[model samples]
Target chain A: MLTNEILQQRLTEKFGELVYNFEQPYGMLTFVTDRDNNLKVMNFLKESEDLGFTFLNDLTAVHYPDQLGKELAVVYMLQNIQAGLRIRFKVFTDITHPDVFTATGIFETANWLEREAYDFFGVNFVGHPNLIRIMNVEEMDYHPLRKEYPLEDQTRIDKDDDMFGR
Target chain B: MSQKQNIQLPEGSLGKQTTTLNLGPTHPATHGVFQNILEMDGERIIDAVPTIGFIHRAFEKIAEHRPYYQITPLTDRLNYCSSPINNMGWHMTVEKLIHAELPKRVEYLRVIIMELSRIADHLVCNSVIGVDTGAFTGFIYVFELRELIYEIFEEVCGSRLTTNIGRIGGFERNFSELAFQKINHFLSVFPKAMKEFETLFNRNRIFMERTMGVGGIAAERALNYGFTGPNLRATGIDYDIRTAHPYSGYQDFDFSVPVGTTGDVYDRYLVRNAEIWESISIITQAVKKIKELDPSVFHADIPDFYLPEKADVYTKMEALIYHFKIVMGETAIPAGEVYHSVEGGNGELGFYLISDGGRSPYRLHFRRPCFIYYQAYPEIIKGSMLSDAVVTMSSLNLIAGEIDA
Candidate 1:
């Protein structure tokens, strides 16, 4: 029954500026923060005796190409099963210089998710111990999920240049 | 820790000549184009690096071009075993973006169909796991039930495998009388079939030995890896998207979230079995609830978005106009982003869509359950035997279509 307002106030009182943007839509709480304080906030959420978000339900990324300002956004959905509450955290980064701190220390499940985001969107996770491509080939260069990638090509493919000789 | 130095191995030492084994983009056990390059030390798997993208068809890219209605068929291919749930999830996401309120009768109908699909999906998952562990008979038994379920789907949607049944507002058509009759038949026989499957695998000593503690993962570890649905619940976390966050009027139904003592292959097997029974119970309840509501109440008020009845289209000019608008996707939809999730057979299947006040979504993303679980494949199989790796992967139920999509 605790509203987002009370949760926001409690979070602000505990960590100033670290609370960031708290948006509640459809009775769900979403907090947006800078990459620098991601781990700080995650650890605080996990270890805090009061608000324990013990379960990491989902983790994924969103790329906003048109906005052009915040090109890539990573969202983490966390659930406190005991409290039956879910909260989302979004961290923004520019595509050209996409980098964010890793949450692997805070939650082990994040290791694969961070790698997946890196593989698809080319968002680099600093301090990730094993930051290799999880979905695509190790030799591949382009990130397939980037907004700039062409879905289909109308131009004819030269047989000589075609990798599979199509 | 900051020091960097060259460490050389003694002459003729165990240098970098580890044998590599490609599991598949074509092997039997790899399960649909999932290839893993395993660096081997004799029979022991030293390190395994999974190679995907073989089955990728650029679903997101295609979704960009199509209207919201056209994307439902595309989602059917994501996790093909449970296409109905994927279809429902996509529709719900679009409905959320437009802030459309579905009637209670429609919600009940959706729950019934979704629960039926969940049962079908889990049957296939458990059966496939059995097949991987050298029990072929169990696969046939469950697949028989799957065929019956598919028949019910075909009767309702006019398609068997890739059924894009529901529209944004409601279903494309109400369930036919024959479809309801077939469902009653299936419901009558399904419990006996489920018991047969449980007896064949759950009680078998060989199946137990092959699965029990084979790929044990703790609750904290499973949660960290973002496992949801049955796999997460198998680890004793009583989190079902239906219960934790109710959608489609799931709160009206009474069911229990089954949990396991240890998050092993056996625990997953048990959890799925229990889920199948729970889904059956939910489906029965939903059908009863649907019967109590007025038939007209099973539709949204948004005429422009929903297809007009064939008879109405002929008789009424307004109905014809709405039909045209529905076909062309010219229905008025708001500009917004909404992430709608359902308790998919494998896990939480989420559809996140961004609408730019257009008929077509500006951006659509499928948070596939199999994709997330496959990411943690290597980690779970670590320190497990080479053969156990295959069983572990199978038990995780990583559908390549969903993962690569």
Candidate 2:
């Protein structure tokens, strides 16, 4: 039971402005950090005995079309197995060149999770050994989960759905 | 060893090159739609690479267009073996986001349904492991009990598989007396079937030898891979989402979280078996608790979101408008971010939802346990026999729908 106040203070004491955008939506401690320092923060969280956020719960990304410069938000959820504390750690990257340092170096589980993020949202994990499409076909060109693409299937039989029900 | 000299040598490689054998995008041993290319030195597997995504239905992308209520069917397809747990997890996530208070009766009802699905899920998994270990009798017997669980589901929901059962606040309708009777019937019959299953496979020398040391991973490595549910418990980690997050009134129940020491196939099998007993205990407790409450309080008092009766829609003005709004998927959702997880059949099934005050989710991601644990497959099967690889895969209890989704 680590409180948000102590977590915020501990985070600031370790890395000052690099750990910013503090918000606790639904009482889960969420924060933003520089995309370049993705590995740096992950190493700190993993190596520190006091923090011990060694468990990499999830690593996925979200595409924001409206955001300028930083259009893709790569989120990494970390947890401490001993204390039962969870934190949503996020890093923003540019859509044109999305390159955040991979977490596979810290956690072995991040390999497929990073590949999935690359497969879906085109978030490039810079140091990843095999950065390729995981969930989609190798022949497919574009990422399917991005906001620019339509959610409807291209092979749908109902061609003119705009005329009737949405 | 002289077989190496008979083969032609490659340009720069030193040791003997291994034979490449593909174990399906369609192999029965894989237990799902998964392709693993293993480089073998005769019988020993040098390395194996798991290539997934054979059935990626793009569930997260599909959730973007669907309204809050329409997303239930999408969840049903994830882990079809235990569709009710997924349904309730999604419902609970939405309820958490909106800060909706559920009745004690609804909580007990959800616990019962979810635990029943847990039993069904474990039965499929453990029995399938028995079949993989060359014990097919147990699988056939347990499937009959699984059918009984489905009958209970059909009584509660309209459909057997892919049941879009409950609404956001609670169930769409109150449980009928037949549903209650079906639960009671299942509760009595399933335990006897379960005991027979354990007797068939528990201490059988062939079954134990096939599973005891095959595909064994240490507890530390399993934790690094973010293993949860029975798999993690098999590795001796006592982290259960029911006890951790305690959603859907799981905190009110008294059930032990079973853990294993070796983290091998046998350990996983034993862990799942112990959990089924725990789930049965939970369902019985929930039944007793639910019997105390008024039957009509199945759904919480959320009229604007819940659908009205067909007769009331024709008569009442308010019911007509509410019905029109619900059918059209026009209920205004509040903008927020919420991550809710439930103890699924496979593992901890988590739903991370971000709503931008629109009908659809801005971004929705399922923390699929199969997807996470399948990453460690290549590591576990390295240097093990090819048949042991198959045994290991099935023992992991990976459902392709959840893995690909």
Candidate 3:
């Protein structure tokens, strides 16, 4: 029942410029921010008295290769369980050197999720404790989710020669 | 391409030294082909490492080559237990990219079928948790109900496990009156069957002892792991994607999002049971609402996107041409990216689609609920007894198909 304007005002007062663009689409508030301010903004949101985004609903990445400047974006869907509000935070990163500050300190669940993001999209989470591959094996070089990976050309033939005869 | 490597334990000073055990890829406790190497000190698990990708099929890569319409069948294979929900979610994502509006009746039909699938999915979760705890009878009772639900699916889609029933814009076929009657019959029996399941396990002393306080996590920790759906709700969070963010006219249906005080295995079981009841309530309301509305309301208006009726294709040249175009997946959809998520039985099932103004999506990613929950397994079972690990993993209700996809 909380209005978007009131929520935005409270967030702005609490975290200043960290609260970037606030827009409501499909009846949920989306907050956009730069990679540099992600951890600070998340900490404030978690610890703030008025806004307690206590639950991280979902975390996933979106690739926009053709967009003029930003090539990759990671969207985090956060939920304040007490207030029943869901807000989405998006951090834009350059595909070449995609790195973002980790939120594992604030939310313990991000430990594996950040690893997954790192494995699939090759986005580095700078402060993660163990950022090694979670889904893919350690030696695999390419990030499968990146647009340049060319899904079609990755032969249907078995890549693991040990398991299947060539 | 290296030979299988053996894990070597360090030279030990005494029994207190660390002992390493590889628990899966064939172990009985592992429900699927999941392998976990654990460092243990006697009965306590010290550190656990999970290695997956055993059943990886590279689905996203294959989707890029297929046309928009052909991908529906591929989505069905992601979470094989709840195939219809995945199919509907994929269709909705494509619909969002194209900005196509589905008819009200079609939405209601989707609600009915999807809620039915939710009940089926939760039945497996509850029953499988019982099986993992050495209760075999519970599995049979719940699976019987699941079989009845699958019978309805087989009648409607002509396939049980992988039902590729949805087209791009709407459904491939409207629910026949017979299918509706069967669904009504299933609903009539579902509540009683649920009560029977609860009676069998809800208060059983052994079941409670195994699950009530095992593998618990706080709300804050659960949030950080990006847990969604019932597992997150079990952590006392009242966030349901359906109620928090309504999609497919879910706002019209009246239901409650169950929450628990402790995020334990028992809480997870109770929450899923409550959800089965809520799903039944939603399906009943949807069936009634759909029957009242006109049947034509179930069909979307985009002829180019929707497959032409068989009779129309035979009688009209334009219909034949459109049919050919749809079959070839040559229709040009506007370029855009859309994330469409629905509350799947396990958790939030999301489809993130990127279209490049082409026939096929340039990129497609699935935010699978199982993958997120399974990733948290090591942390949840840390320091607990080895037996509790099986209980915890089953309570998480992970589907290997979804996790690997």
Candidate 4:
């Protein structure tokens, strides 16, 4: 009963041009919105009787350094288990001031997920209680998963490909 | 000597107060490296704080640097109990991005491998729960069945624990006759052993008392915490990735999703036991279905990703060129984002990939189900006995590699 068209229409009718870039890459309905309306859009999707996407399947971040002003993209994969419907949405924020509203109040599982996002890409979830490093140690000063940071240490010349076949 | 002058009673030690106990980072009862700080009032736990990431390897960051085929081994470590499911899940994710259509025989072969590993994973988890609750016979009894399953993996892919069994499109080689014999042998032997395993613990008064009503959670709370796989099914939710979103021709196989009420440690055990039976049925069906298809169609016709035969590589120039490119990890993939999940050992193991028209992925994230559900541990074990906490942890099937990955 819940087809892609109905879900898209319901979203468009509710949020009106606010939610854009409707797409179905590999048959999953994915859309994009600004960081400001993420909580509003997610709450509407959860509270609305017709659109009951209560299960938060996944929450992760993608770092794109080339994209100016929107260098960080936070992705949320939500599913309505009863209806067997899943929808993905992204909220892009600037790298310098990467702040997005917390979804802990909406989904309890978002607690550690937000901490993980903040630990890796430094996406500061506003009003997130106890937002600290989850995977990496507390003393790590830099977000390692950001595009600005390289996977390997540049200072280690011994393992350089030119000198050693690595 | 009775009271030393230098000795001082700590602030809360003078009065009767809760004792703080650190359960593990390497405790044998934990089964893995998980540290849970427990605030206890005698034998009952008042609160618990679980600390993970002792085994975090930063697989996501590592995947960004490695090529597509190179990431399969990384997935193998996610849940070593059932590495094939993770391997096949990663392959399916890439296959989805590339739009590679696989043959029926290939999919059936994958189903057989995946279900066999599922049985292996469940055997370890269920038997470990038995050992945690003062029952050791079941642990030693079912492990041989797990070993037999591993032998099948060894025959197929030449490895044991971390069986990076399959390639991007399909298997590296067709299933050998010996492999089929092993499958049939396991299929014949597993059912009787599983029935014995169930008889040992299903209605045993001691196990029932120790696990039932201990660390039980409501179905609604379990869902809010992102429970999936057997854990979610144990909570009475019939949501299964294989049925909800069928992939790798799971729709062709018919099997019922088992559910349990009360979502306690006992219910989790029963659900896993029932699921083992269902997996047996599925593997039997797949073996029959594979016989109907052509045996030569193992790997798909994606020469860019799938490596050519060794004989062809040695003799033919075109095969040599394809082998060199595939081995050197120079296959440039299209720029796209795809999220694919398979019903893994513990839950829904997902791969979220983003490619920017490069040999390696732009970014790759593993939606580790253990990492999500483990967050609900402190809540699940709070206000329960210390021993109950250990039993609950085993029932949740928290794998350290998957959690910290």
Candidate number that wins on TM-score, 1 or 2: 2
Cα deviation in Å at residue B102, candidate 3? 2.8
Specify the CAPRI tier of model 2.
Answer: high
Q: After superposition, how far is residue B89 of candidate 3 from its true place, in Å?
A: 1.6
User: How many times do residue backbones clash in model 2?
Assistant: 0
For candidate 3, write residues B13-59 as lDDT tens digits: 34345789998978877778888899887788988998877887778
Model 2 C-alpha lDDT per residue in residues A122-148, reported as the tens digit of each score? 988999989999989899889989988
User: Candidate 4 residues B1-405, lDDT tens each?
Assistant: 234467567877665367999999999999999999999988989988888889999999999998899999999999999999999999999999999999888999999999999999999999999999999999999999999999999999999999999899899988899999999999998899889999999999999999999878889999999999899999899999999999999999899999999999999999999999999999999999988889899999999999998999999999999999988877767888999999999999999999997889999999999999998998998888999999999999999999999
Q: Which of the two, 1 or 3, has more TM-score?
A: 1
Q: Which candidate order results from sorting by lDDT in descending order?
A: 4, 2, 3, 1
Which TM-score value belongs to model 2?
0.96
> TM-score for every candidate vs. truth?
0.90, 0.96, 0.88, 0.96
- DockQ (Cα-based) for each candidate: 0.40, 0.82, 0.39, 0.85
Q: Could you list the CA RMSD of all candidates, in the order they appear?
A: 5.0, 2.2, 5.7, 3.1
The residue pairs found clashing in candidate 3 are: A109-B224, A109-B225, A110-B224
Error of 2 at A40 (Å): 2.0
**Which parts of model 4 have CA positions greater than 4 angstroms off?**
A156-162, B1-16
lDDT agreement of model 4 with the native: 0.92
Docking class of 4: high
- What is the Å distance of residue B325 in model 4 from its true position? 2.7
DockQ of model 3 vs. true complex: 0.39
- Flag clash pairs in model 2: none
Structural RMSD, model 3:
5.7
